[model samples]
Structure formats: C-alpha cells, structure tokens
Target chain A: MQKVMMGNHALSWGAKLSRAEVIAAYPITPQTEVVELLSNMCADGSLKAEFIKVESEHSAMAASMGAAAAGARTFTATSSQGLALMHEVLHWATGARLPIVMGNINRAMAPPWTIWTEQTDSIAQRDTGWIQIYTSSIQEIMDSVIQAYKVAEQVYLPVMVVLDSFVLSHTNENCDIPDQDKVDAYLPRFENAYRLNTDKPAAFGGLTGPDWYYELRYKIEKDTERSLDLFEETGKEFGEMFGREYGLVETYKLDDADTVLVASASIASTARPAIDQLREEGHKVGLVRIRVFRPFPSELLRKLLAGRKKVLVIDRNISFGMSGAFYAETKAALYNEKKAPPMWGYIAGLGGRDVPLNVIRDMIEQTIAEEHPEGDIVWIGVKR
Target chain B: MLEIRFHGRGGQGTVVASKVLAFAVAREGRFVQTFPEYGVERRGAPVVAFTRIDDQKIYIRSKIYEPDHLLVLDPTLIGAIDVTEGLKPGGWIIINSDKPAKDFPQFAGFKVATVDATSIAVKHRLGSAAAPIVNSAIMGAFAKITGFVGIEAVREAVHELSPVKKDENVEAAQEAYDTAEVPKEQS
Candidate 1:
C-alpha cells in the first residue's frame, strides 16, 4: 500500500492486478526483479497464470506473442541487450496487432558492457510499432502498466512501459498503488474480435502482393493514426474512474511560459525540480513528459507546444549520426503546428552517467538566459 | 541553499544518503534534488553524490565542485579527492572520524565538525566498527551544523528506506548530532 517500492516492483503489482494470464521473461538486471516477483506470485498460486520461463528475451517475446495470439493476456520485460534481442518479435507482436504489454527498464547498451543506466536501449527502437510509454516516477511506472493494458487492448497494439534502469528502478519511492478492484473495473479482458486458433483460425500476416501491399500498409497506418484518439478516450475514462488521467503527452505549467522542457523517463523527474527552481527564481519554464512514443501523438503535442517558444528537449539516448531520438520525434510532432517552438536538443545522461538536478537547472538557465543559434546538441553532466 | 557532497564506496549508501537528505529538506516545505555521479568503480571505490536544497528552488546544473557543506563518509577520501576544494567560506564540514575536529587541516579556515559515526553505529549494533553506513549519522551532524533540515525529518525519511532499524539510525544520528560541535567559527 504505502510501502517504499522500487519502480520495477510497482510494475509487477500492476501486471498481476490487471489479470495478466501469461508472463514470459528471462532475468536481467533491474528488470529481473519485476519478472521474479511475477514468477513468485505464480508459484504461490496468488496469480492464476502460466509463467513461461523462456530461453532468451527473443523467445520471451515470441512466447508472449503466442500467448496473446491465443487470446490470453500476456506480458513480459527486458533491458538493454535483452531488449535488443527481442527486436525481431517486437515488430511481429505489433504487426499482428497483439496487445502484449512489456516493461522495458531503460539500460545502456554495452560495448565495454556497462550496466548502470541510460536510455539508448529503448530509444534505438523508435521505429518499432509498439506504443512506448516512458515513466518519470514509480507511481507513473505502476500507473502506466495499468493504462498500457487498457490502451493496448482498445487498439490492439502492444505497449512498452519504460523507466530508467536504476534511477526509478532501484531507487525506491512512495507510490500510491491503485486497488485491485479499481484496476479490474478500469481494465477488462482481452476480447479481441480476432484470435488465432483452429476453431476460427484465419490468416494473420498473410503474404501480400504489390497490388495489395500498399493497401495493407495503409490500413496499418490508418489504424495506428486512429489509436491516438482511442488512447485519449480510454485515458478520460480512466480519469473518471481512478482520478488519475494520463495522455500521450503531459504538459506541466507550460501555460504562458516561453520555455518548456520536453523529456521522458527519468529526465522528467530531474527536470521537474529544475523547473520548480527556475520558476521560483521567476523564470517561466515548464515540462512535457511523453507517455506515448509510438503513434507519436503528433496532434496532442502540436496543441501543447504550439505557441511556446524556445522549447528544450532532454534525451538520455542518441541516434548517433542523426538527431536526438526524442527531440527528433518532438520536431516531427510539432512540424505541422501553426506556431512551432524552436527546440534545442540537450543530450544529458548517457551510458548511465549521472544527470543531477543542477544540470537540468543549468539547461533551463541556458535556454532562457541566452540564445544559441548554432549548436544542435548541448551535452550536459560531462567533465569539461 | 545547502549543497553537500558525499564520498564513499559504491554500495556505502552515499547516493541514498543524499536522497534521504533531500526528502528531509522537502519535509520542511522546500524543493530539493539528490543524485549520484557514480563511476565504474565498484564496491569500495570512491563514489561521489550531490545534494541541492534551497529556500526557493535549485537549478544550478553542475557536479558541486564548490560545496557549501562537504561530508566525508570515509576519512581516507580526504587524500584521494579534493574534498575541500569547493567548500563555501564560513561553511561547514562534517567528517566521520575518531580524530578531533580541529585536527583536520583541510577544514582549517572553516567551521569543521567531526563525529565518530562509525563507532556510534557500532555501539548501536548497526554495523561493523570498520565501516558503518554513516550517511544518516553524518546527516545528523549536518542537521546540527547547517540547520538545513531537522533530525526528526531525517528519521522520518530513514523509515522510507529502512523501517526496522529506523529508530536505531535515528538514535545513532542523534548521538552524532550531540557530539557534533562547531569549533567557534574560524576568525
């Protein structure tokens, strides 16, 4: 109830209460504890579900897909390399329109094999069709899982509830976990119109020729676009029931503010304090935490960031040769808006480097205090 | 604003200490932030964490090189890192050591405060005499010196992480609080 829980633990609680029937995962740092809790719950008969101890993260997604395709509520989790391994099936899960929820702890991918924290792991998979949601706090981590199930089932698209590996994962905090009944009422079963079985076995992912390929692709694109609306409708419904409303994009104190921060995952948490500090010093700074990464919520963001000038987007991951992934997405979302904010991308923490509150504060200070016309990225929290 | 830097091993609870301290300050209705600039250094390597607390809000985004309050968890870090490099003028230093507060030369021009938090942790049967997680104890002295946060709030924050031994850490911290003395602020 009121106990201090790690972000991963909070997610497991949400999954179990959501009546998830199948859990398939392999142990990995930060994310391992989440699967471990589910395994224990299933072992003790507390959770009436089949726990599939998979061979690898790749198989974990495959098995979860099979479970969901077979009309059972399915969930899984991975981090860093583990998520990289699940790359193949993530597309399959989303392509097949299977509503599988995954809890991905955002860990830095390794070359020297680092395991501390970073956002490169999840951000690299931006093109993956799953609806990705990044969380700033443990409360949001738990709440996101519950919301993911509702939104995923509504539109039949998979959702990834993401959090910083250790920042929100290992760092325990006070979270108001929703009651089981409230979640039960909010999220019903996965009664999709289509399920893969012998009784009514129909073609899923049937081959397409050039004549039908464009139409099939267009259908998927149209469904993806329609999902943003469904997400808002379900979010409003959730708000009415649980009093906690979430959106594809959340704007905090951005009204009449010239500079607003755009961030997701734990950067949102760090930016919040910096925003408070800047505001106290009479600086008009606000925050936007992204809840949906895919179906990119372009319309929602266009409205929020429309008139605001000098927006700063903080990203933990980078696309290397290209722009910051989150910042690039922010630009795409705001491209059609009448009043587009000139976004400055700030890549602060990478490879699990420490991003302190001061770094966030300084970003606000720099964004508001001066105008940089040339620099595309200002990497903070690095030793100069 | 009270900016504190903690030096310890990776698992020594330095990061946690900074977080609990921030929450304690938050209990006073102030906005604060706590974070660690951890390295690949494992187990016993010198790890550094930072804390920012202000009456209004804190936005300075730098690893505190110049700290208003510098805390040393392991006395050995005094030689390894520049613990005194950024200490504010007329600021404070709280060290976990057996030596007298006056004996530390780096704090020569500052209001230095010292306490045997390790021994206090041992007396309270908290941990080994060698290294007891002295964050709460040092924070106890921190509370008494800078007056940024009260000991009660620290105790309450400790319960968030460690409930079973909350009172023990609180008592151990209070003991350090009692022994903590500012050597008549430097002239």
Candidate 2:
C-alpha cells in the first residue's frame, strides 16, 4: 500500500518488514523517530521482535552485535554523535562476521553542535569494513533496508544504510510499502551455522596472533569485496519481485554528455533537476549518483566518467585538510585510466545549509568555464 | 509540479498541516513531498513548511522557493515575516483569518481567500480556545479555494493522521470547506 511517511518511519517499516529479530537503538534527533516507531510496532504486536532498549549508542551497537552473534537478524540506528559512539563496536561487528544491518542518519559531527545532515559522519567509517549504501529518497531507504539484510547475510558483513538527516530522514513522501508476504518471499529467515550455541561449545573472538589474525583480516576484506556482486544479484532479484530496482550507481543523461556531476545522498536527488535544466539550456551535463559508497563501485564510475570533458563532484561533507571524500575517492578510482577526465571537488551544504538547484548550477557552470581545477577544493556558497 | 509554502507559529501544526495535505494529495494517486524548515522548532516561533505535488515522482530534495501557492495558518505572520516572499504572482494565498480576503490589500495581484479556522477549530473543540489547532480548517479552506485536493480526501487524511480528536478535526475541515470565503472575482 502507498503511504505518506517520513524517512525515519520508512526505516522502521523496513525493519519490521525484514522481521528484525532484535532491535537495539538509542534516541537521537532525526534518528529517534526510527526507534520510536519500531518500539510502537513491537508494543502493538504488529511486529514480533525483541526490542532492546539501550542506554547509549555504544550499548546499542554492542547489544545489536550480541543479538546478531546469537544468529538473530539484528537492526539498530543512530546519527552523528550517536554513530560516533558506535565506532569501536562497528569494527567488532565486521570483524566478528556478524551481518547486522544498521541505519545511520548522516548528521554532521558536532563541536559547534549540530543535528543537521552531513556525510562526513558515515564517510569517516569507510575503513570500518561495513558495507555503506547511501540512499536518496524515502522509498529507497525502505527498500535498501530489506536489501541490506539480504546482502549482509549473504556476505556475513554488516551493512550501514546511510541517509541524509533532515533531507530524507524528516521529510515525508509517498512510498509504496511492499507487502509482508512478498517481502517474506524475497528475504527468508536468517540462519547461521556459526551462531553461538550452548550445545556446541566454542570460544569466539578470544585472541589471535599475527599468524591467524592476518588471514582473518584478509577473509573479511575478501568477503566485503564479494558483497558488491551479491548486492547487485539481490537487487536484481528484488526488482523482479518488487517494482523498484536499485544499482550501485544511478546515472542520469550520461550517455552522450561531456560534463558529469557526481553526488550522493539527497544531493544527488536534487542534481537531477539541475541536470535537466542544464540540458534544456544546451549544456551537455549529466549526473552519476553513487548509491553504494562501499565497495566504492570504482569500476562503474571509472567506466562512466572516462573520456568526459570534466567531472564535478559535490560533497556535503568535508574531509578536513583533503577534499570531499567522494571527490578524493572518485579521483583515486580514475587515476590510472588514460582517458580520465579532469575532476573538480566541491564542498557544499554542510550542517543543513540548503543545496538549491542554483548552487548546483553554479558548480557546473564554474567547472565548465574553468580550463582546470584552480584549487583542491572549491567551497560553494561559503562566506569568506 | 505545484509547490506550496506553509507559514505558521511553532505551537501550531504547521508541519503536520503540510504532511496531512501531502497525504491527501498522494491518496488521490499523485506524487507528493512535504517537509518543514530544517531547524530547532520551538513553540510560538515562526515556522515554515513546504509541500510539492506532482504527477510524477519528485526528485528535487531542496526546500521550495517561488512556491506556486501559499498557505498561511496564522494571519499574524503576514507582516512579521515575508509570507509571500517567493510566492508566485496570481497564485492563491489562503489565510486563516476571520476577515474577508479584501482585508489583506498587500496581496492584490494574488488570488486571496480566508477562513476563520481558529473559530472553527474552537467550535469543534479541536484544541483549547486560547490556542486552537487550525491546520485542519485551513486545509479545508485550501481544498475549497484551490481545488487542488478534494474535501473528502482532506477529511480522510485528517481522520488517518490526527492522533486525538479525529472526528472533531474532520468536522472542523468540513465546516471550513463549507464556509471558506473565496473572493468571487479571484475564484
């Protein structure tokens, strides 16, 4: 059925549809509504799941890890500071090979104190071995949650479904909620032979010397890489069942374009119209929206961006002294390619500052007017 | 796509009003998106919300600027803030006021309409008389003035979304729809 719901409620509905066996989450702005709805569903008996109330975000991940370690489909959500609190356990969940699906609202990290959207929080965890999938709309957020569990369980690696804070999290839109029976057919029950069982006495995550630790780390990396294909296969199968099919990267008007815009999360959604306007004005502009950030989709990006006149990357999060994270990643992905385009990095819309269509148009125009990038990072709409 | 910007105080159901309207529009098989100003909301503070209705899925995530119409839940917000800052000329400006549309001379070029939503909300016992919830009545007035959505859809949306006083809210919308004051010249 089609329902108008906030992205947070969509996450809750996704978790309920996936039949998450255990939900452990701490309340934070934007992310609080996700857990609130899930708790309500649990209380109303609509979804039968063990809702674990944790005192902190750290405990939330720890409990989720514990639940997943016991062979249960565990889900948890947090944003910004809350997500920062789970950094240590985030690594442990991956190292333990637990397929815990977490919904992390991409709120900007605070010292100045903000609860608004930014991609830096989630991008900081890029090395944590968790598969990151950034979503742009409420519908994708809901669909990705179920797909996250499917891909995570197949590869035995945790998946972090990241979305913009207020842009997608608080915004309400009409989304088609997949039927429960259809979802059941798409994603079966979670079963793991390595689950902690009393009958089969085994010690887990005790300690490993370099002799075994190196191989263990290698195995994690190998499986993390394998998730790319699993995610694609699962998405294709899901599309066969449900109407919406997702991909690692979604391209808009890129078939015969000279300039391409690279963006993730809600920024990518906003870029579509900017691209359309630019196209109407006779500018050969297009968009390459990076949906799956982890496993990077480097090959797909390299193929799409090669031979283009220029590629402008708009990042909502800054990587401090460097450029935008996506900018750096895209550049690195295309470094060896002979036909690689001259890439320009732009940082815009941090801390909930709006990235209107005009700002996006400005980025494209600046990139088009310049012969080469003047600086490592071009800050858009920032006061000098 | 038809874009609407809603103006109201924080204590009022400004955001919910946008969502309820979006819900109603979506129920009619059109695509809709609604969201509030991304800020720390406090009661009585000026708040703004936006809703976009389109025949196809909306891809623009930015807040609405140059809205096709405006929904002002609080009449006091007119001069306090530029309620019509980016409103398109000739677009409908639906306001919740006891006075007629002609009372607001500043909105000469636009199609103006008014409904005493506060009185209607209070009469229906939707909220306390001091701070009655006027969103439902304003939505009804919106339905009546613009005909963007049907009155039945508004009632159904209010019935589905209102946590308490569901019937009262539905009745408030019906009464406002019945008595909404749209200038015949503009209509």
- DockQ scores of the candidates: 0.16, 0.89
Q: Which residue pairs clash within candidate 1?
A: A117-A352, A358-B60, A358-B61, A359-B61, B66-B86
Model 2 regions more than 4 Å off: A28-30
Q: What lDDT, from 0 to 1, does candidate 2 have?
A: 0.91
**Chain A (alone) TM-scores for all candidate structures:** 0.95, 0.99
Candidate 1, superposed: residue stretches over 4 Å from native: A29-32, A36-49, A192-216, A241-243, A258-261, A272-287, A306-312, A333-346, A353-384, B1-5, B10-36, B49-71, B84-92, B108-111, B123-187
TM-score per candidate, chains pooled: 0.80, 0.99
Q: What tens digits encode model 1's per-residue C-alpha lDDT throughout A215-312?
A: 86676678778778877888788789777787777777888788989887777866776787788989888888887888787777788888887888
Candidate 1's displacement at residue A208, Å, is 5.3
lDDT by residue for model 2 (A1-384), tens = 989989999899999999998999876554559999999999999989999888899999999999998999999999998888889999999999999999998898987998888998998999999999999999999999999999999889999999898899999999999999999999999898799999998999998898899999989988887887887888899899997888899899999999999999999998999999999999999999999999899988989999999999999998889999999999999999999999999999998899998999999999999999998999988787
Model 1: how far is A46 from its true place, Å? 5.4
**Top candidate when judged by lDDT against the true structure:** 2
Worst 10 residues of 2 chain A by lDDT: A25-34
Displacement of residue A106 (Cα, Å) in model 2 is 1.0
